[model samples]
Target: MGTFKFSMKMLIRDYKKSLFYGLTLVFAVAVSFVFFNIINNNQLADQSIAVGGGTWQNVQTPFSSILSFLIICFCCFMIFFANNFFMTRKTTELAVMGMSGSGYINSTMYVLYQTFVLLALATPLGLLLGRLVIPCSNAYMYERLHISKDVNIIPQEAYIYSFLLVAIVLAMICVLTAGYLHRNDILVLLSQEKEMNFHGSSNKYKPLLYVAIYVFGIVMMFMNPHSPNAYIAPTLVGVIGVVGMIRYVLPDVIKHLKKGVFLTKRYRLISISNLSYSIQRSLLLFTLMTVSVTGMMAILAANQQNPREFVTSVIGYIVVVLLLVVSIVYKLIMEAVTRKTLFFNLWKIGYTRKELKKIVKQEVIMYYAILILIPLVYILFIAGRFIYYGDMTISFAVIFTSAYVIPVILSGFLTYFEYRNAVVKPIQGGK
Candidate 1:
């Protein structure tokens, strides 16, 4: 009991250090919840309109079902990751506890205590944040078009349940992570090093190969975007391309950026290294951003005077962009913070500016490529398909999505590059 209480107190005392991570998890989960909400509302709206009755209850039930489904997944992932972080942080402490005559049960209990402390702190905040999203989203949609909505604001009771569920999942993750500590030897715990051994191929031509694969995927996706059938093959291609780039292409990209090759253009080598280490993380981040921007562009592409255009076409674009932007920004900000922590660690390892610059360049290029590819492929395959099978009116939407890809890619790359420089320079110089 004493050890458990002490662990909780220590967590609270060190809360500032953990706060950013907690908030980031909360934010990601919150965004996931919101996206789920959007999807729920849309499905509900379609059902109600189709059946021609049942007021908002039809929408409400579906909304709750989908929201609950999404929240469960989000909570699990967030809690598991948080538990892993806690275990890593407390490895030495747990080792000491075990050595000091504490049984495995005691250490596990201590871990549970810490997990509950975090859950208690995070839950209410997450619920409040989730509830606040409703009015803001409603206003944005309303402002996008003056269309009145039958949308219900997120109820207070919903927030309470959300908090409870999130808390329970986090607690369970804590128990799991703590159990791992008990199962490991004391020596193993004490000697553990926090090394990230991400696997990848060492081939020199990997980046270009991945770039080609991604291009091919995009072309495939765009080849027949309008047919639901067309999207399947392209979607599979996209998933493969993204995975290939992350696992194989990214590491080689960093290498080429550091040691320039004849095939690489003048600034291309530098750019690759600048952005590639966090390639997978950055790719996911940019995909979210691209989706968001695409949605916004879609809205602008539509004719506003027509009610149907405003509801279907414009709203569709808005939703895509909103989903993308929300997902991307949430990822980028969290990643940006983590990247700073990484730089601080790198500085401890005696890394130089040249080395850091190379890493940043690799990351930037990988991210830009990934972000650009999604929109381009979607416009090509999906747009063409829509023209052939869905609707000719969507042609303009495709054109705008195509036109908008370059700026979005460039802007995302530049912003992260600058952010990386700002966060790293001070730590590098001990400023």
Candidate 2:
């Protein structure tokens, strides 16, 4: 009970973070409910476009399965990742509680309590949103897919399955929390802050090989629609190359930038120095987002040919973008919490709030640039051919731009605001 009170206080004090988590949880619940419901819709179960129908039903059938599987994996992974961050970030707080005579049991209870509360609030709201979204989706299907499948009653199995999924995620967090608290000593928790090396990656040979793969992959994209051996498309091969570029080539490139130009400017010096190392942490998530956005674009471009694919892809893209925003926001929020000391040191060393803010913005832009640039070149090459062939319009180029660009800018803005709240204003107040 005492731990519960402390947890409640933490939740209320950090209501902004709670709210962000709540929004994400709500989305997970809502999307799960909607997806399970749609995937099991009785009317749409037996029909296939192979028989003589529209293209959408076929795409929807397989794509939703793929999409839902991805969603489950995505949500589960985020929950697990966030939980890990939660435990690590709260290490110091837990250490303090230990000093106050709170045992591991109490500390574990405290974290679990807060997580449970957030999940409790999110589950019901998400269900409501799921219920509301059905009608909207039905309307879309009628207009775009040329079919009507009214969701008069939400399937009981869907409700049960969605509820079970969240419960499982919640249970997994509880177990992981208990395990972390039980396994680590106070020293281990305290030492975590010193773990990340600020000097950044320092390898050279990796970039040469990865750059070759990057070039080879791009060339293959133009040459082969499908690989002869594995039957994988060159686009996928190109995505793999992009991953190598980030995981390898980027750090080496920055080492040069540091020597030539970026080191000359204070803000650029800080941003560039940090970015290469930061790329290591961000590479996987950024790759996933890039793939999702790229896949979303491919599906959307197909909409010109298959109207069914358009509307459904639009719905899926909206969800993808929303998830992308929340996940990045979560990353930024977690970084701010962990890097408070680094920012505070910068303040004492001679950086002002204004300058620190600029540095933060620069870092955000560099991240966005790395994320978009490779994907942009590939998209433009394919889209140019499509447009010339009269398969796609110029208007779609505008849409593709907005789709990839807007949400990133939005996440950047949110990250900046959160940084000030988490790191800057507190320092200013202390001063």
Candidate 3:
């Protein structure tokens, strides 16, 4: 009881961290519920066909299985990263506990307690939200398609499956927490965030591996083996390329920028240098942006290629909205966690708050440029196709504008807000 109370207090005190955890779980549950509903719908369609009914033949699979796989992958990745970030934030406290002679078992217990508390709260809310939203979504789809089938709001097996998946995720988090604690002692854990260092010697051959993977993915896409597999192969390859671009390509680009006369100006130098130093973290943000953009492109392509597929189009739009939200939330949280201290030190060393803001703004602009470039190029290609087909309608224009403008506006707002809170507010507070 005492230990549970302590865990609850800790969670309450760091409510922001817990909030992200809960949100991730909510996302997971919602996605899982939707997926199960999809499977159930597919089963019903199959049954209708088996009963000598041709009326349902025109009802193409609304939700692609590949989309389900992507959702699962995204949920798992978010959960792992969120949990790790929470643990990273608690490094100092954990070190203190360790120094005071807290046993490993106690630390593990604390983690389990926190996990249980979050799961207990988030699971029901997620399930309830999923229950409410998914039915409406299905009903909307049916209305759009002019289908007479009744919407299934509650699927018994789906609810059970979602709960089981959530449980498995909780178990994985507990195991990971235990392993991380067991591997690192107090001193190492305490110093974990002190510096960002890249110890690997440059290997000229690594770029070749990335290039090969990218090529392979392109080839696989052209081959077009199957539905889900086709999506997976190319996407997985693109992810590797994005990560590589961040890890290898971006740093090199920054180094070249530093050599240029333009960026060498003193005002710009700090931002460029900060970007170079924190390249790994910068890469992570960029990677998220890249993946989101790529996912959006994929979804839009599906909608464009299958004009009659209203369900696919709707899913595409939904995915784009979700990606934008995820990107904004992720960037804000990560920037707060990783860059706050560095910005603080810059302030202490004679840099003004305005200067810090400029640097941040510059960094963000660069990221936005890179993130938006690919998607914009693709959108242009799509526009070109519309022009060629003499189908450049107002609807397309509206969609293109919304898809392009909204992410840019939202990203800019998030960047400004993060810089204000993480860097500016602290400076103001110190005064």
Candidate 4:
């Protein structure tokens, strides 16, 4: 009991330090929930009206699945970074606890306590904020459409369930992180290495693959912008190709940092390194940006009173998807090149294979799920369906296909790389 109390106090202190990250995460989740609720509500109403009073609950499964994925993926990254931060700050303290009378169980309890308190604070507020936004957003949409909605936000249920779910998931991540720390090598805890090593480089021919994927995705996006289902296949293929190439290129690009052809080469190397890290650490962010931009274009295009209003919405979605496809492809190529450079630099700095693997694994996991999966699923299912049912076009169908398939492949590829880097590399080093 005393230990638990002490651990809870420590957890509070640590959580205070993590306030910035936690607050931002909570805000993002809240806003996303609100947006999702609005979109889901709109879709359900539309479908219900079409079916003449069919239950909205039937159509909610997909939306709920998407929400679950987002919460899990987001929490995973948050925990990874938070745990990493915690471990770095408390290595010596943890080491001392292990050496003294305190056991690993006591330490693990603290991790759980901290995670629970964080979620306890964050989830209710998120639900409340989401509840507040839904009504306002619905009012705007209703006024714009000049129609009334029969259904309204279930704030109470949403608040209770979502808060509980997210809390449990985050707490699980905390447990895993604590378990890892508890089993950490004493030597690693004693004098932890700063530098990270990586030995991979990019292939020159990879640019062609990236270009091909981008071009194909563009073609699909333009061919049938209105048909959401049609766009799925092309989007999938393009995304997969881009992810693979980026995975290959990102590490090397950071390694071969040299003066560019232009005269403004003073901070080029630093810029390149930072950009590379961002790409590797935040690929999901870039993807979300693309999805969000495209969605915005769709909404705006749909609203225009101009001559091309009808045509524009359809075209706008396609155009935005194409733009996203191109950006992702380009980023992948650049990231692959950058990673190669960074890996070589790490080697030069005498970072061990095991240490580098851990960093890369953490980074890859962070980028793949949070940046990629959550937004991709939301765009593909919720937004894709909206665009598809609204109008079926060849371009949209192609983009939708690409979007769906790409993330699955990317998830696998990134996971493989992460496992190879984190698990395999360490084992090989030990051998």
Candidate 5:
């Protein structure tokens, strides 16, 4: 009990580290719960039975199945990713604890305690939110499909599925924590915060891997099987491409920016130099931004390709929008947190708050441009096909323009506000 209390206190002290991760779990759980209900609703089944399994039922079965599968895969990936981030943040603290004579068992127990504490808080909140939102989503779907069936807000099966999801997440957290702890010794953990020579050793092979993954994705998309399985190849391609870009391309791009004419400007020089030094973390933020843009672009492409699939297209748009918003907000918050000290130093070196804000704004715009441009080009290539087929319409033009423009504007405002609140305010307060 004492140990649990201590762990809770530690979590509170570093709440930023867990905030987004816990929220991510809650979001994932809620989404999965909604999806599970949609898949297993008794009312839906009864309707199907009454209609003797007509087109609606036939369509609903495969649609719901695909949705559920996607939701499950998303939840699993999110759980693993969130835990990895959480554990990475804790590496230095765990190392310190180990140096202070904490045993291996103690470290393991602490990780477990922290994981369960977060789960305990997030699971119920997620379930409740899911219950509240599912009805609205169902209503939207039914309206889009011109279905007269009443939407159930809470299904009994949702509770069961939600609990099962929690269990699975808990198990995954345990496994990931165990694996992370096993891999790094106290020395490695302690040194993680310091400069490491081996950090760029694998840079040479990264481009090869990146090219291979992109090629694989292109091949998969071209193969284009008629079944749902066809999506797997393209999806894998996207995931691998995003990961490889983050791991290799983004950092390399930043490192090379140091040689440009922009280096003549002091703020640009400083920001680029700082970014180059912390390329790994910078790449993570860029990766999130790239993924969000890519996702939104992909969703827009699909919607444009099949305008008649109203419900599916709407759902895809909603999911991608949520993903983009969350990823951008998360990246901003992380940037603020991680760069707090750097901002402070810049202030000490005679930079005003407004100047610092401009620097951040510039950096964000640069990142956004790079991250968004590639996806935009690819999406344009896809849209060109629709144009060739005479499928480009004013409605799609409107939707595409709004989707693309609104988010970019929102991202700029978000970055500015985040810099002011998280970075500038904190530094000013410290003074």
Candidate 6:
């Protein structure tokens, strides 16, 4: 009883951390519920619509097995990655408790209970959200797809399969956690974050290789955007390139920016110092976000000419991007909280509160610049295509840009406030 109680207490104490990563599980299960619902429903899957004015007809909309599979695969990875991230922090604390005479058994139990809490939090909410989302566009879906049948019945498999996915993720987390706790290497495992010496990778040829892959993937995606294998494959490749470039090429770019005349401002250098690490950690996350939004953007561009399909694409864009925004907001909040120590150290070094505020603002802007601008450029390029081909109006380009930017702007606001509360004000209060 005492052991379980202690575990529960630890979880509650760090509930913010739990909640931050819980967004991942919620999204994971939600995507599962959604994709499974679509996949299991024959009418929704087979419905056909028209495309290309008075030309080749018999076109269909975006929902397909390949897209579903890609989404499911991506969600699975998100769950696994989130699990590892949570346990990496949690187990280290558990090891400390063990050192304080709490025993290894208690440590193990905490891992179990933590996973249970995640399962409990993610399953029902994800399913409920997913169930709700299916009907959001359904009324128009039949009209858009030109189908007579309602196809409005929610699939039972969405609930069953969503829970099943959550279960599998929980199981994997436990197995992985068990292996780590057994080895007892918690404290020494990931001290790289503590160490600040980052000698940018010496390999010059490899970064070019990543850029080449990035260009190739982007080009391939535009060339054959309709083919499922082509779209999903290039996206996978592009993500690798984006992640690799962020991990490898970006550091080198930052190093040059710091030395070059472009970043001559002294204050900006402080932002650079902080950005160097945060961006590195954000590699896969921002890249994955790019894929999610851009995938929907591709649909938007392809369907820009059709009114119904365009509406469908916009709704799809909102759903996919907003799901990611939830994760991004949680992430920004957590970063502010976690980097409190770094901010305090800056405060101790004779940096005033105003300067600290500037640093926070600079970091937030720079983060958005990197996170939003890359994808925005790509999205704009996508929007530009329809304009060039005469399938879309300039206003649609504005609409496309607006859809992606609005949530990002809102996110930037949230990031600023969280940083103030978690880092800036606390420092002012002499903590």
Per-residue alpha-carbon lDDT of candidate 3 for residues 1-431, written as tens digits (9 for 90 to 100)? 65577778888897876676778777667767776665455433433453565434465554454455565556676677777866876777678777878889887787778888878888888788888777776776566545667676555767887888888888898889999999989998797655455544276666667766655655655566333223544666766876776566666666667779647476577676665554465566455555555455445544554422435345534544564456455645555556677778888887788777888877666655666663454345434444444545547655754665676767666766776577656665554
> Candidates' TM-scores?
0.61, 0.84, 0.80, 0.54, 0.79, 0.81
What local distance difference test score does each model get? 0.55, 0.71, 0.64, 0.50, 0.65, 0.70
Q: How many angstroms is residue 93 displaced in model 5 relative to the true structure, after the best TM-score fit?
A: 3.0
RMSD of each: 6.9, 4.1, 4.6, 12.3, 4.7, 5.3
lDDT (0-100) at residue 285 of candidate 1?
Answer: 46
lDDT of residue 365 for candidate 2: 79
Better of 1 and 4 by lDDT: 1
Report clash pairs, candidate 6.
none
lDDT of 4 by residue, 1-431 (tens): 86668667766666544464356446544654554454345332444453676545545443333433453444445445444544554555556666666676776665556656666777668766767666765565555555566435543544555555575657666667677776785556654323233345548677566656655664666566464345555555555545644555445444644434322443344334444555654455464444444443344323443322222233333333433333343333323433554554554566555555555555444444434543354344434545546643546545654654465356536454634443334332222
129: Cα error in model 4, Å? 2.4
Q: In model 5, which runs have C-alpha deviations exceeding 4 angstroms?
A: 42-50, 53-61, 191-256, 274-313, 344-354, 397-401, 420-431
In model 1, where do residues sit more than 4 Å from their true spots? 28-79, 82-103, 136-164, 179-216, 222-225, 253-276, 280-431
Winning candidate number (TM-score): 2
lDDT of 1 by residue, 253-304 (tens): 5665456562445345434533454455455444434433433332333334
Cα lDDT tens digits, model 6, 156-191, are 766787777777777777788777778765455344
Top lDDT model: 2
Q: By TM-score, how accurate is candidate 3? A: 0.80
- Tell me the tens digit of each residue's lDDT in model 2 across 304-376: 5555445556767777777876777676666666667777889999998888888877887787677667667
Order of models, best TM-score first:
2, 6, 3, 5, 1, 4
Ranking by lDDT: 2, 6, 5, 3, 1, 4
Q: Kindly report which residue pairs in candidate 2 clash with one another.
A: none
Candidate 6: RMSD to truth? 5.3
Once superposed on the true structure, which residue ranges of model 2 sit more than 4 Å away at CA? 46-61, 98-106, 148-153, 193-196, 199-202, 226-232, 302-309, 337-341, 385-391, 420-424, 427-431
